[model samples]
Target: MKKFLSALFSLCLVFALVACGSSGGGEASGGESEETFLSIGTGGTGGAWYAIMSAAGAALNSDLNLDVQATGGSIENMKLVTNQSADLGFASPDTAYFAYEGGREFDNANPDLRVVMAGNMMYEYIIVRADSDIHEMEDINGKTVSIGAPGSATDIVGNEVLSSLGVEPAETINLAHSEAATALQEGTVDVMMALSGVPFTAATELSTVEDVRFIPLNQNEIDTVVENNQYWSGGELPAETYEGQNQPIPGINVGSLVIADESASEDDIYNLLNTLLVENHDEWEKGHNLASDFTIEMMETYVENGVVLLPFHPGAEKFFEEQGVTLNK
Candidate 1:
């Protein structure tokens, strides 16, 4: 009887152990592992930031759980990150600075915003029909123009450029990038301005079917804009950036940045950088032509040029440190 009872107890212990192992232990079973979940806020669907960020989310899906949301442009993205509704977001240097410092459009300064990395240049492209009599910045005065989506970085900065340069449009329309492109093609608007990366989808599609030209900003005027706005820089789109553009078009450029809330874990952000920039770079390149320009070297240039507007998240700082680059913050 004693032997029987002992054997029964042993069998029960074994089953209990097996149950515990299968029920609650975090060890991978059936090739499934725990995933860290995150969210990213990007620009409108038609913009480069949206495409790039969506590609990044998919590339990191194997390692982490991430959701990408298309929001209004830079200003709205920054707001989302600050409100903790988003884990990270894309914004221009100027918008990030204002959001962090509490000025232009923000109700209060959000000091919690930190940069994960500086991405591509958002070139200010003031596009017009090829045969339009508007040849220079001054000609845009008294003409119908689509600035950008309302309350976007493009709208604020575009207005600043025009206001400073003394070019006032007779009628200003605020529309999404793709909608503005359609309006321009349909001759409903005379000028469309895009603050986007190279090979912008709307601009590319617009150029393919219509004879288009980028209105050039005077270098001196651009210099003045740069001097007054610390985040703005004078940049040019090289000839052939688009099908119909033959000469380099001069305009304003701002650093596009990835920002995060201060509460995010360092390890998670570091792993994200590893996956997007190292492990799945090829897939990222397939996302957009602008992806090729998103590199450690490009970030270094932003740092060197003093365009990085906010402090770096600790995880990103660690990753950049490993690459022999020390960020300003």
Candidate 2:
């Protein structure tokens, strides 16, 4: 029933976007500028993906003569971009890989998908009660857990990490980050897994409200996990992201990328890429702290084991190659 409702919601969003696409004539703020029209689909309205990409779209409108519309987040963005209802979208590279390869939720591969720029998700977190017996990633086995909302970036990665660790709980719950935290406090689930920036609010709130201790992936465990998933890297979650968390939590660093639809002309993609990656990076940083860490070298390193989730649009390829960098699949 929940799956049906979720699919219905997506279809409704796509149908509404189709209407917006047909009405056309969306322009930059003033009537004076005849800009190149484009749309970027991000997550919900208040989240980081939405806020940063909304700012990015706005900046593209004012400076690049591009009329940009910010739509929904990763999943909606994927649907919109694949159908050409939206020109660009943001998604975790791993989830994007799943989408393009027909590996996870996708029924058919999105052949038109292509990656542009990538950014890091600060850490991957697994949390349990302070007094709980689960002290490490392996301890999660046989426990009840909430793996994050169905179809969310966290859910996708959470499942993948569990698979890599060879750990599966006796039961699983699917809820959004906040709801999952609530469920944990209410004793509905025994553990919570999240992939987010440090001091993840929901996890932190749980700490303030409940006596909790984060489960860490020891160095050997990190090695084992990353050995199977190149998209993951061992990292420290930093101390004090939450109360009683005086030591860094061992976790993974993953990349989230901006991808484009093939239906967007090559020139449009090139222009947008150049404007964002080179000319307007500073403007983006003012709004998204993640942008500050985005560099060509980091972009080069994010792709894993020569397997790309989405192919690069010719335009993005051109820009990067001109910079003497080449991305491979």
Best by lDDT: 1
Question: Which runs of model 1 end up more than 4 angstroms from their true locations?
Answer: 1-31
Instruction: Give the per-residue lDDT digits (tens) of candidate 2, residues 10-116.
Output: 99999998777555465433434345767776643323555566556655645354334434335656877788877777788766877687766778887778887
Model 1 lDDT tens row, 162-265: 88788889999998899999999899999998788887888888899999999888878898788788888899998998877989988898778889988999
lDDT accuracy of residue 11 in candidate 2:
100
* Error at 219, model 1, angstroms: 1.6
TM-score of each: 0.90, 0.76
On a 0 to 100 scale, what is the lDDT of residue 321 in model 1? 87
Task: Give the whole-model CA lDDT for all candidates, comma-separated.
Answer: 0.85, 0.72
Model 2 spans > 4 angstroms off: 1-31, 35-37, 44-48, 55-77, 199-201, 204-211, 303-309
- Model 1: which ten-residue window has the lowest total lDDT? 23-32
